[model samples]
Target: MPVVLLRLQEATGSGEGGFTPFSINTGLIFWTIVVFLVLLGLLWRFGWPAILKSVEDRERRIQQQLEEAERARVEAQRLLEEHRRMAATAKAEAQELIAKAKAVAEKERAALLAKAREEYDELLKRARKDIQEEREKAILALRREAVDLSIAAASKLLEAQLDTETNRRLVTEYLATLEQQR
Candidate 1:
């Protein structure tokens, strides 16, 4: 043990001179490079594939989310356009309905006015016909009265000593004159 300790102390040169800790040792450097190469190879074979796969999956997920958002935006825009078109169609239909209603109302008013005019004309015709009939009845009554008065006057004249043939001839002439004047 004492001999091994003396050899290790001589190898580090720590007995007679103070050695600089920053100085490179060739054998230690060679062993460190060999250990580093073995560790790098182990990590490349066992750990790198899983890390790379996880990163790629995360990227794909993000891209899919972006595509879904874009599709949603397009669908919203289409719905808005459809709503506007429907609103415009409804407005046009309402206007058409209003116009049709107005037309029907106008037609009904015209029909009512025409019916009133026809009734008024019929009433006027009836009034004129009634007036004409009354006038004819009055004329017939006046003719009957005139005939009765003439006959009475002739009877009185005959009682006062007029000839019957002359009285009858005068009454006939007077009746003819009255008819002509009428």
Candidate 2:
């Protein structure tokens, strides 16, 4: 402002100058500087602090939100791990159950086979016993028939001369000789 005043004085001292076209106003410049300084001081004292506080609060809120998100991510990962472990355990248990079932089936099969073998052996034994009994009965019937036939033939040859006792003795002796030849 002082420099403007000095330039104005120099221009007025020049010879062909009426009120100069270009002139600086010192009072207006001084008053404009004063008003600008007053407004700057008011912003620094009040508005600056409010803006700073709002920015700090926003930053703190963002930090808290980030921490919460990290904790949630960790919890999700833990749950996934736990689920995998449980699935593996269940699979192992299912395999064990299958093995146990197979073992039981094998045991049952073996028991059934053993029982069938025992039944077969019993049936074979019964069949052999029945055959032996039938063979003995047939031999007895044949011997009786032979004896009767021999007695009748011998009586016919003797022509009623020989007695019963002598006929029987002769037949007995003939049977003994036949047995020795066989």
Candidate 3:
């Protein structure tokens, strides 16, 4: 590496007065311009076209990727909206089911209440009929007791044995007349 550097310095005449970047040499400038022009022509003919083609292809690929990303995002948004609509529909159906169930339950409750009221009314009617029958029985028993006492008293006042069947009929007729007057 040192031998190459020494040869390069000797070629540039660095030993005479060190290298001066701003030095003017008409021959060196002429050769430098010639070489620069040749290099520029080569790049323009071959390298530039290849570099431009590669850059254009990269730009087109990037644009395609961006478009694909945008399409994917739009599809995702559409799916999200569809999902929300489905959820709303399901919720509405569930609420409707609940409302129907409540209506059915309310109807059943009303029917049960009506049945209970009917049963209570029937029991009350039966109780009233039984009470009426008991009252009639008590009245008949009292009348029979009154008739026996009257017959015994009449027998004692007369001081004679009388036909019991006749006495009973007479007393029964008298009591019936008294009832009609009242």
Q: What is the TM-score of each candidate against the true structure?
A: 0.50, 0.45, 0.42
lDDT of 3 by residue, 58-83 (tens): 99999999999999999999999999
Give the clashing residue pairs of candidate 1, or none: none
TM-score result, candidate 2: 0.45
Candidate 2: 10-residue stretch with minimal lDDT: 15-24
The residue ranges of model 2 lying beyond 4 angstroms of the native Cα positions read: 1-68, 143-159, 162-182
- Candidate 3 global lDDT: 0.86
Q: Whose lDDT is greatest here?
A: 3
Candidate 3 segments whose C-alpha is farther than 4 A from its true place: 1-75, 143-182
> For candidate 2, lDDT tens digit of each residue in 44-74?
8988889998999999989988998999999
Backbone collision tally, model 2: 0
Query: Which residue pairs come into collision in candidate 3?
Result: none
Q: Least lDDT summed over 10 consecutive residues: which range in candidate 1?
A: 15-24
Clashes of 1: 0
Candidate 3 residue-wise lDDT at 128: 90
* Superposed model 1: Cα runs more than 4 Å off: 1-61, 141-182
Decreasing lDDT order of the candidates = 3, 2, 1
